[model samples]
Target: MAEKSGKAFDFKLFRRLISYTNPYRFTFYFVALSAILLSAFAVLRPLLLQKTIDESFIPKDEKLIVFYISLILGVLLLEVIFQFLFIYFANWLGQEVIRDVRVKLFDHMLGFKKQYYDQSAVGRLVTRAVSDIETIASIFSQGLFMIISDLLKMVVILCFMLYYSWQLTLIVLAVLPFIVFATRVFQKKMKTAFEEVRTQVSNLNSFVQERITGMKIVQLFTREEIEYASFKEINEKHKKGWIKTVWYNSIFFPIAEMSSSITIGLIVWYGGLRAAQGDVITLGVVIAFIELSQMLFRPLRQIADKFNTLQMGMVAANRVFAVLDTHSKINDSGKIELQNIQGNIDFEDVLFSYIEGEEVLKGISFSVNAGETVAIVGATGAGKSTIINLLNRFYEINGGIISIDKKRIDTIDLKSLRSHIAVVLQDVFLFADTIFNNITLNDPTITEDQVVKAAREIGIHDFICSLPGGYHYNVKERGVMLSSGQRQLISFLRAYVSNPGILVLDEATSSVDSHSEQLIQDATDKITEGRTSIVIAHRLATIKNADKIIVMDSGKIVEQGNHNELLEVENGYYKNLYDVQFAEVRDV
Candidate 1:
C-alpha cells in the first residue's frame, strides 16, 4: 500500500523492468528469436492445408495428397521443437530475472534506516520482496513475449488471407474494431481490479503475520474469537477483490467468444454465396479463410487476458520500485575506518527524537573514558536506549556531536564503528537455527571451539553441554526453546565471543532469576573488565559499584556521581531512585 506512481502501463517503468535483462542479454536475444521463429512456424500448417485441399483433393491424386500431408506433418514437428525451446527458455529467463531483482530488492532493504522499518510492516515487505516479485516473473514468460509471438502469428496469417481472397480478408478486418474496443474496455476494468487485489493482498499478509507472531498474547487474553472475526473481515475483502476480476472476466470472455463464432458464421455464409454467384471462390479457399479467422480471433481473445498479466506485473513492479526509490538509508559517506579503536565515547549536546517536535534526548551530554564502565540509570522512556541507537548510527540525530576516540563517530566508517561494539539487548532475538550458528551467526572465521571457549568464559558452556545437541542444539524461532534467562545467557555468550572494544548491556540481567542473575553478573564482570562499557539498568543495586552512575529524568541528565557520592547528596535524583528500588527489594 505504498503510494503508487505512474500509470497502470508505465512505459518508463516497463523499460526499467526490461533492463534487468541486460545481464542476460544473450539469453534474452535468443528468447526473442525463439518467439519470432514460433510465430513464423505457426502459419505454415494452415497454408499447407489450403494447398492440400486445393491441389490434391479435387484431383483425387493420392501421391500429391500424401506429399502435402507429409509436408504439413514436418512443419508441425519443427513447430513443436521451437515451441518447446520457447516455453522452456522463456520461463528460465523469467526465473533468472526475478532472481536478480529479488536479490537487489533485499539488498536495498538491508541498507534502509531503522526508522524506515519502524514505520513499515514486515509482512507487507515480505509480500513485496517475495510474492510480488514472483508476479513479475510472468511478465517475461507469459506476458510480453507471448503477446508478441501471438501478434506476429496473427499478422502473418492476415498476409496469407489477403493474398488468397481480399473480400474475405476485408470481412475479417470488419470484426476487429469491435474486438479492439471491447479489449480496451476489459483492459481498463481489469487494471483497476488488479490494483485493488494487490492492495488487499498486502493488507491480508500484514494482518495474518502480525496475528500469528502475537498468537501467544491472543490466546493468553482469550481473544481468539475476536482475532478470528478481524481476520475474517480482512479475508472477506481479499475474496471480494479477486471476485471483481473474476466478474469482469465472466462478462468479457463470453462476448469475445460470441463475436468469434459470428465471424466464422459470416465467413461460411459469404464464401458459399460467392461460389454460387460464380465469383470463382473455391471450397478450399473458404476453408482456408475459416482457419485464418480462428487464428486471428484466438490471439485477439487471449491478448486481453495476457494484458491483465502484464498489468498485474506492472503494479507489482511499481510497489517494488517504490522501495528501491526510497532514500531513507543512513548516510555512510564517511571514509575513516577505525584502527586500534580505544573506545573513548563522548556525546556532547546530543539532541534527538523519534518524532519531530517531541524530543526524546534533549542536549544530552555524557562521556565514557577508555576501559571505563559507565552506568545509565533512568525510568522507562528516559531516552537511555535512544542514546545507544544514535551512537551506533542506527538513527540519525537532529543535532549532536558524538565522537569515539576523539574523532566524530559519523566520520568513522559505519561498519568499522559498529564492528568494535557489541550489544546485549533486553529482548534477545535468535533465528530458527542451532545455538552455535546463532552465536557465531555462521561466520566461517569463528569456529565451534572458539564458540565453546566464549561460552565457558561466560559460564554457559556447561549449561549448553547439557542440551540435546550441546552447541548444535536448535533454539527454534526467536530462541523460543530456551527460557528467557537461558536466552539472556546465550546473548551474553554471543557478546563475549565478539571480543568487542566497547560493550553495551541494555537491561541484560533484568528478566533473569537470582540464580541466572548471579551467572550474568559473573559474565558481565568478565566481559566489561577491560572494555569501555555502557550499562542501562533499572535496578540500582546492579550497578552500585560502577565507576560513574548517570541519572536521567525525562530527556536530560539530572544527576551524576559514584554511588556513595550520589547517596551523600540529600535530595539527589540518583539518591531518591536508589531509595525507591532499595525499599522495593526490602518489601519483597
Candidate 2:
C-alpha cells in the first residue's frame, strides 16, 4: 500500500529510522567521514593521472614520473583503507541498530493483550521481528549511507571534469537524461515489486509455520497432499514476486551501462577533433576525462540499485512501525499493588464480546470468598474459559467490574495481580527443557527444594523421581515425550510451586487416561486444600465434592448450588447435566 502511494520516499519514516542510530553516534560520524574522504580520494586519482601524463611523462623527466607514481600508490592505499572502514563501520551501525529495534519490538509484543494474539498470526509477528528488522538494517549498511557516498563521489568527479574542459563536459552531459529517466522508472517499479515480495514472504512463513505445527493433524486426517498443494500455490506467488524485481533489474542495468559507454564515446571523439584543430583540449585532459566518465557513471548505476534498497527498507520500517504503533496492549494504568492477596474474586454483571454485538458472556455475575474452591460447569461455548481470561485481565471486559479483595482488578497493578494467581490450562504447554526448569520456570526465587517440597505435598514426587533424570528429565516441546496425563501433572506442579493464592484449572484432567484420573484427582485435592481455586470441568464426578458449583449455558449462568442441592431441584440445569454425565459414566 505504501508502494502504491505517489511519494517514493517517505521522509518522516526515514527520519524515524535514522533516530535509532543516536546511541552509535561515534560509529555513524566515522562512517560519514569515510564517505567524504573516499569521494575526495576518488577525484584526486583522476587529477593525479592528468599530472602524471603531462608534467611527468610528457616532459620525459624520470624523477617526476617516479615521484608522481609514488604519490598515486599512496593515495590508492589510503583509499583502500578508508573504503574498508566505511563498509565495516556502516555495517556495524546497522547491526547494532537492528539489535536494539528487535529487542524493543519483542518487548512491545510481550505486553500486548491476549486479544491481540487472538487476531494475529504467530509467523507474521516472527517475520516482523526477525526478517523485517533485518531489511531495516540494510537501510543503514547498503541503502541510505551508500547512496549518499555514491552521490558525493559523482559530484566530485563532475566538478573535476568541468574544471578540465567545459566543452568536453558538455559532450559527456548529452547522454545523462536517458540514464536519469531510466533510473527513476526502475526505482518506482522496484518499490512496488519489493513490497509484494515482502507480503508474499510473510504469507509463505505463516502458511509453512501453521502446517508444520499442525503436521500431526495433517497426517492423521490424510490431508498432507491437500496442504502441500496449498503450499505450492503460496510458494509460487513468492517466486513470482521476486522474479518481477529481477525482471526490472534485467532491463535497467543494461540501459545504465549503455548510457555510460555512449557518454565516454562522445567525449573521446569531440576532444580528439578539438586537439587536431589546435584547440585547448590536451591529450592528458582526454585521458583524465575517460577515467572521470567511469567514476561519474558507475555511481549513477549503483545509486539506482542502492535507492531500491532504501525503498525496501522504508517499506519494512513502515510495517514494523505499524506494529509498534498498535494500541492493543492491556492498559496497565493501575497503581495499586496488593501484598499477600486473599484471592477473594468477584465478577459483577460483567459483559464481553470477542466481536461487536456478539456477546460471549452477557451480564455474568459471580463471587468467590477467600480460600474457597468453586467449580464452574457448562457445555462447550458457555463462556466458561472467558471467565478465566477476564480474571487475568487478558482481555478488558465490555462492562462491569472484576475485583480481588474488594479492589477493582483494573485498579490493581497488572504484575501484582497476575503474580498472585497461577493457571493450569487443559492444553498444557511446556518448553523444550528439563522438568526442573519447567517446574521452576527458571525462576531464581523458586529453587529445586521448593519445587520438590511442593511436588511431594501434591503426591507427584514419586512419579517425577521414577523418570530417568527425575526432575531433570527433558520433556521436549509441549511435553511430547510425556503423555497427556504426565503433562497435566507437570502443569499442576508448576502452578503449586508458584505458591499462588488463587489457582485456576481449566479442564486440567479432561484429557487424562482413566488410569491417571485417580492420581490427578488426588493431586487436585491436595493443591486446592487451602488456596482459593476455580475449577472448570465437563465431568460431573470431579466437582461433586466442591463447596459450590456454578452451571452455565450459552452466555449466562443457569444455576448455582452444591451437587446434592442442584440434584434435588427438578428439571434443573445442573440436575440434567449431572444425570447425563453420570449415565455416560455408567454406560462406559
Candidate 3:
C-alpha cells in the first residue's frame, strides 16, 4: 500500500493545476472581476442599513427613507447579477478544464505498455479518469476562487466595521483566536477523513467492478455467498469512511455557530450599556456591528468547508499527475516504415519473462515463411500465449531478435507493424453493439456490405442472418447474448475484414461447440489460404493438416515436423499429446 501524503497545502500542486486554466483565462478573469464587484456590493448593504436606521428611519423624513431603501435595493440587484456571473463563469471554466484533463489522461493511458496495465485494476483506472477528475473540478467551482471571493468580502466587511466603530470591531476581533484554532483542528481532521473516504470509494469501486465483471465465474463456482460476504465487508468500510467525514462536520459547524452567536450577544450587551450611559454608541451602530460580526464569521466558517474541497481536489490532482508522469510507455523509437510487409517472421535466441528472473520463454528460435501455416501445440503454462504477446510487441523481449521480412521488428513503426497483423484470441470479446458495428469496429472505411461479404466467406453469414435484426442485432455487453461459437465467428470476421498479412489464432477454437468448431475451421481455411498464420492449440486434432507443427514444453520446442513425420517418432512429446487426445475422443 502507498503511504498517504502528510503535507496539507501543496503550493507546487496548486500552481500546476492553475496552468490548466490557461486556455479559459478569459472566463476566469471575468469571474475574478465579478468577485470584486460582489464583494464591494456586499459591504455596501450593511453600511446602507446603518445609514438608513440612523439618518432616514430615526427621522420623520419619508422621502429620504424611500430614497435610501431604493439605493439599498439597487446595490442588492447588482450584487445578484455579479453573483450569477461569478457562479456561471466559475463552473463553466471548471467543466472545461476537467474535460481537457480527462481527454489528456485517457490519451496517456493509451500509451502505457502492457506491463503497466498488467498490475493495474481496471476499476482503479476508471476512478482516476472519472471520479478523480470530477473532484479536481470542484477546486474551481467551490474551492480556490470561492475562498478568495469570500475572504475578500470578509475583508471589506471588516474595514467598514472598523470605520463605523473601532471599539465594536475590537470586541469582535477578541474571539477571532478561538475561531482560528477551531478551524485549524477542523481542517486537519476533515483532511484525514476525506482522504480515507476517497480511498474507500476507490476500493469499493474496484471490488464491485471486478465482482460484476466476473459474476459468471462466481455463479459457475457456486461462490455467491462467499463473494457477497466479501462485498458486505467492503461496503461497510465505505460506509464508515463517509460517516467519519460526517462526524467531523457535525462537531465543527456547531462550534462555529456557537462562536458567532456569542459574538452577537456580546455586541448587543456592550452597545446597550454604552447607549444607556449616553455615550457615542447608538442603535444604528449596534445593529450594524451585529450584522458585520455575522458577515465576518460566516466566511470563516465557509472557508473551512471550501478548504475541504481544495484539499480533496489537490489529492485528486496528485493521483492524476502520477499517471501523467509515468514513463512506462513502450519505446516508439523505431522509425522504420515498412508497408505491405511480406509476413516473413523470425524469432531468434529470444528470451522473455513476465516476471523478472523467471523466464517463460527461454532462448526460443523459430521462423515462418511468408505464406505458410504453422501450428504450435503445447500444454498449459508451456509459454504458448506468451509467444503471441511477445510477437506483437505487447511486451519488450528480455533478449531477442524478432524481425519481419529480414528487418528488425523493433525498428518498424508500431502502428504500421500492428496494422499488418491480427490475432483472434481464445477468449473473444465483442462490444455491446450490433453485429455489423462489432465486425467493422465502427471503422468508417469498412462498409456493411464488405462485412457481409467477409462473413459469407467465413460461412457464418447465414447464421448471423437467422438472428433477430440480422446484422443489426444488438449483442449486449461482451456479446453475452450470443453463444460462444457465434462470438468466435464474429471474431473471425473481424480479423478477416482487416486483411492482415499475418493471422494468429490463439486457442480460438478451444471452447466452441463442434458445429461452431466446423464453421471456425472452414473460416480458418478461407482466411489463412495465402496469409502467414500461427495457430496455438491445445486440442491436437485441430492442426493435423498444418504445413508444420512445433511441439513445446517448459518454454522449449522439443519437436518440429509435419503431422505424419512427428507422429512416427516414438516417445516424442507431439506423439504422446496426439495419442492422448485421440484416445480421449475415442472414449467420448
TM-score of each predicted structure versus truth = 0.98, 0.98, 0.98
Q: Write the per-residue lDDT of candidate 3 for residues 1-588, one digit (tens) a residue.
A: 122467767787788889999998899888888888887887788888888988988886899899989999999999988888889889999999999999998999998899999999888888999999999999999998889888999889888888878888988999988998999898888888888888888898899999899998999999999999998999999999989989988998999999999999989999989977877888888988888899899889999999999999988888888788877777787899877878898989899998999999999998999999999988899998888887788999999899989988789888888878899999999999999999889989999889988888879999999999999999999999999999999999999999999999999998999999999999999999998999999888889989989888999888999899999999989999888989998999
Q: Write the per-residue lDDT of candidate 1 for residues 1-588, one digit (tens) a residue.
A: 245653546788889999999988988888889888887877888878878987999888999999999998898999899888888888999999999999999999999899999999999999999999999999998999989888898889888988889998888899888988999899988989999999999999999999999999999999999999999999999999999999999998999888888889999999989976877688788888888898898888878889999999999988898888888888898899888888899999999989999999999898999999999988999988988899899999999799999999889889998888999999999999999999988879899999988888778889999999999999999999998999999889888888898999999988889888998999999999989999999988889878899899899998888999999998888888888988998999
- The lowest-lDDT stretch of 10 consecutive residues in candidate 3 is 1-10
Instruction: Rank the candidate models, highest lDDT first.
Output: 2, 1, 3
Rate residue 224 of model 3 by lDDT.
97
Clashes of each: 0, 0, 0
lDDT of 3 at 267: 94
Evaluate model 2: give its TM-score: 0.98
Q: State the RMSD for candidate 1.
A: 1.3
Assess the local accuracy of residue 193 in candidate 1 as a C-alpha lDDT between 0 and 100.
93
Question: 250, model 2: CA deviation in Å?
Answer: 0.6
Candidate 3 overall lDDT versus native: 0.90
